[model samples]
Target: MSFNVGLSGLNAANTALNVTGNNIANSATTGFKSSRAEFGDVYANSLFLGSAKNGVGSGVTTEQISQQFNQGTITNTGASLDMAINGNGFFMTSDNGARVYTRAGAFGTDKSGNIVDANNNQLMGYGVDTDGKVVQGVLIPLKVDTSALAPKPSDSLSETMNLNSSAVAPSVTPFDAKDTNTYNYSFSTDIYDSQGNSHSLSQYFVKDNTNQWTMYATVDGVNPHDPTSTVPYTATLNFSSAGVLGTTSVGTPTVGAGFTQAANGKFTLTDWVPAAKNAAGVMAANGSAPADGGLVMNMTATTSYNTSSAVTAKDQNGYATGSLTTLSIDGEGNMFGTYSNGKSKTIGQVVLANFANVQGLTPNGNTGWRESASSGVPVVGAPQSGTMGTLNAGALEESNVDLTAELVNLIKAQSNYQANAKTISTQSTIMQTIIQMT
Candidate 1:
């Protein structure tokens, strides 16, 4: 009986050392939760021996208890592909139909643009529609549709160009068909075609007279509104002293791939003019110009006058040529891409999901987990909402392992194991002495 007790002690010590070794080995493992060995003394007893003052004590038994999931330090590593769970939750992923959960947020877009975890498991999330909005109560696996991802032109063009409001328009000289050239202002940028092919588009604003200007534009190698296909596209921009759209404008003929412009000389100065007014007020039809009267012109056309057929928007056939710029993502996951044409459009938004019992999830390795019967259905939601953590773009969350704490625990477990080993040795010595005496 004494030898059996000593043997049990030895077994317990061995198990404790093994547990410590496991902790040390996984100290650097990402999303790894250190575990402690649970021990309980066994009592040898029976109803028939209940009257005994003390029953024989059996050695310790080893059990791996639940792991501690306290929050880990969230170090921000500037990686857009990195994600971190700040609170009580794990990222849900699915391998084929096998669901798993994890705290590792290192994610990236696969060749198909589907968000995949390190193990190639698809990150589960609600799908966002074309409008970049997630429908309620519908939880589907999320995947980025790379094939369908394409840049689209903007539907409308908005511009605020500032010119010397007091500048005089040039007189109509046959040699200078566009008298507005006196002002001599030109700006150019690249605009995309229907196929997203870029083309250089330029606009020159020339002062024609006191309040009129002729705008000339060139697209690709051809002029969109040339009179004989030999001249550049030209339009008149007229403005009253008060910067109001004047009645003098030209009706352009349909030309170009997806745009039309008025014939070079046919566009009148007043047709596309906008109301001209200084900061003060509009100028009167009478010769009385407001003290701050200036040349301000704004014009919009029902038809695209500059864009190529290749530059159509997603839901529309054509967009204004002036609708191109850069792209950006906001905290709300809204993706905005700008075009060289000075236009920006919402491209798409990111999606996130949540689970009711993240702790109840079963680990499936590779920093991932699977949904078990213990874990309730996942509750889907966007990031930074309710219990969900805010998303930090271009940043990744580092591993949550506390090296110091793990080391300390390792020391404690080792000491405990050593003490148990000593007890076993002492017990063995005593049993040997008893046997020798017998």
Candidate 2:
């Protein structure tokens, strides 16, 4: 009977030692929980002798109980793809067709642009509109379009100019009718044509007289090749002596003066038509001095102006069509993409997944775990919202194993096993002495 009790103690101690060894072996394993052995002493008694206090003891039975889960320390890796749950949530993932949950965040994008976890489970998110507003009930797979994105140019532009009323025309002139020696004004800017082709645009100005000027534009060159009209555009600007803009005879209010178009599609400057003296009957041999020879002066335009002209031009509004450049992620998980055209755009935001219960997760190998019946449904959202951790780009998370604690537990289990062996040996020695004396 003493040997039986001693053997039971040895068996129970061995079971506990084995359980501790298993814990030590898997201390470094991801998502591993340690278990402990439970022991119960057995009692033997007859139905009639059950009331007696001197009942015989039978031995012990050992069983494995619940595994204890220790919260692992989280180490930041700083990767936008990498994620970590600080509290009670787990990340939900899928294995091919099966669903899984885990606390691990090692994530990446596939060739198809799908955001996947370690086991290739796609990360989900809410879809966003053009303005980045959430579209409810929309489950977007975390894939972004890597194609080229460009800036949208504004639709309108404006320009203003001022002229010096006394500058004289130079003696050397380039045009027989006009002086190349005149202030040849040229201002260039970029503008996209109707077809989205960008061109270097220039507006040329030449002083025709004191209060008048001529304007012409060379698009892409001194004169752009016009496929439809077969001619470059030319116009004139005219001002009254008081510097007030005149109106066209066709009832078009002229805020400023310019050449008028003829029925033949030709442009000509406005010249004084000596008021047809009383219907051509009262005209003198020479027309009376032309009404106040239009004020003479050189044109000097600056960056300031106030005009109501409906057609305004810009200095620089277009860019050269370019290819895609580098990409980056921001604090809000927004992906900003750059292009060779000196333009930038917001591509999309990264998605994060969270579960209701992390401890109830099922292990899926590769340091990943999956959702089980005990784990509630996954709650998907962007980082930094609703208990989710913010994204840190270009970093990874370190394992949460504690080596010092595991080593200490290993030593204690060894000592306990030895003590239990000694009890078995002492019981055997007593039995051997009793046998020798008999």
Candidate 3:
């Protein structure tokens, strides 16, 4: 009986030492959780003896090893794909087809552009549609699309300018794009076609009278009405005595050719063919068509004031094809890809899984855990949603192990082992003494 008690004590102490050693070993591991060994006192029981008031403790037995799920310190790693959870939740990954959960966020892109961990396990997340909208309630492996962004044609152009009302008529009679004396002021802007081709649209303003002006428009230095002719498309601007623009008239050559005034008081150019200039300064079609529904030009903000003629604001909606430039992740786990065209689109959103009994999860090595019957089904959702925590991009979570505490535990376990060994040795000596007396 004494031998059995002493052996049990030794076994318990050894187990404690093993647990402490493991905790100390993983002190520097990322996302490692510390564990502790729990023990219970042992005693013999008999139905006939009932409860003995002076019953002596037999020994100690290992009961269980429990894990600590406390939050670890987050450190910035400056890697774009690295992520860290700030609170409760684990990053869900797919090892082949099996779902695994982990707190380690050291992730990178695989050969196929799929975001994966060191083990090549793909990370799971919600995907985005072509329009960059997040598709909820569906799980998919997150991948980065590196395809070039398609170009968008120009459909709208807006300009705001103040024409000098005190300016006199140009000394020249007719507008000549090559002669500055034929027009008081001129402005040019670039507009895109369906094929991403750019064309220059120039406007020349000539003061005709006290409150009237003649505007000549050209595309690539030629008439938009008849590309073969050098005569520019003409429009008359009539202003009230108060210097406010009123009813306007575009010359008959442009009334219905490609430019028309809409009921909303804006001009719409529906037939302006995209053209390019040759080396000899001749303009011709470039085989690209205008945007669908034509280009809507808003010039209602034009004011004729007694000031210097200048364009206050001008903008066009168009872009050329672009390639992916950078990737970023936000607190909500939304991944965005920025392109060289100065545009950004949603790539995917990372999803996190949380269990009701996190401690009941089965360790699957590599800092990952598998769902078990003891651990309730995973509650998966985007970060910062519901009870889940927010994500920190370009960062990682460090192990929660405390080296000082583990070292103290190591000393205690060693002392327990020595005491147990001394007990066994003393028991052997007593048996020896009994034998010598006999």
Candidate 4:
């Protein structure tokens, strides 16, 4: 009976040492959780069911090994795609046709633009729809849009400028872009066409009176109305005594058109005729008119004051084709992609999952776990939603294992082993003495 007890104690001690050693080995591992070995007292029955004083308790036996799911330390790695959970939930990933959950966020993208972990298991998430909204359904591998962006035609433009009131009117009658004497001040901006082609939009301002100014607009130095005629699109500006603009009158492009004009006399361009650039970098007139409507220019804030002439703000809603430049993930797990054209779009969102009995989950490899019957069904959701946690981009979670605690446990295990060995040695000595006396 002593031999059996001593052997069981040695086995239990060895198990403890293995558990502690495992924890120490993974101390520096990312997203690693520590584990503990548990044991129960053993009291096996004899072959004949003998009772009373003959009963004896056996040594300890292995009961269960549990994992500790505590929050790990966060370290910023400066990796854009690297992410960490701040509150709760695990990053749900998919293996070869198998679902896996992990806290490990060391991830990279494959050649196919799919986001994956070190083991090449694809990270699952919700993709965005055309409207940039998250599409909730069965999870799929998140793929980034790395293709070149499409161009958008100029739709609206706004400019706020202050015209000099003390300036004298230009002597030139017919406005000509090549002659600087025809206009007082000129401003230019780049606008995109239907084919993503860029064209220079120049506006020349000529003071007519104390409160009146004329603006001559041109594209690539050519009049958009008629190529044969050098006269650019014209507009008249009238200012009030307080320097605020009062009325704006644009030259009628067509004799009969359905363009809507505002009560404030703001100019509206409905149908724009496309133009091309010549070898000399001048915008040459194209014979075909663009099917898309023309560009709308707003100058409701134009002012004629005694101060120096200056343009306060200029903004246009048009951009040429661009390529993907960078990516970012928000706390809500929304993945955003930026293009060279200065436009941003939401592409995907990270998916997170949680379990009712986290302790009951089966520890799978890759710092991940598998769902088991003991662990209730997974509750899947987007990050920061419900009981799920928010995400931290550009960082990773360190292992929660404490080296000091494991070292102390190692000492205890070694001592237990030595004591059990001593017991067995004493039993051997007593048996030898009994034999010698007999």
Off by over 4 Å in 4: 42-57, 171-173, 252-265, 277-291, 431-438
Better of 3 and 4 by lDDT: 3
Candidate 2 CA-lDDT value: 0.53
The C-alpha local distance difference test score for the whole of candidate 1 amounts to 0.53
Q: On residues 232-330, what C-alpha lDDT tens digit does candidate 1 reach at each position?
A: 455666665665434444325354322333332222111111123355774212222111211112243212122221222212222334432344445
Best candidate, lDDT-wise? 3
Better of 1 and 4 by TM-score: 4
Tens digits of per-residue lDDT for model 2, 136-166? 4555566655665444332322344543434
Please give the RMSD to the true structure for each candidate, in Å: 12.1, 14.1, 3.1, 3.7
Task: Please give the lDDT score for candidate 3.
Answer: 0.88
Model 2 poorest 10 in a row by lDDT:
289-298
- List lDDT for all candidates, in order: 0.53, 0.53, 0.88, 0.83
Superior candidate under TM-score, 1 versus 3: 3
Error of 4 at 275 (Å): 3.1
lDDT of 2 at 306: 30
Pick by TM-score: 2 or 4, better one: 4
State TM-scores per candidate. 0.65, 0.56, 0.88, 0.87
Model 1 residue 356 CA deviation (Å) reads 5.3
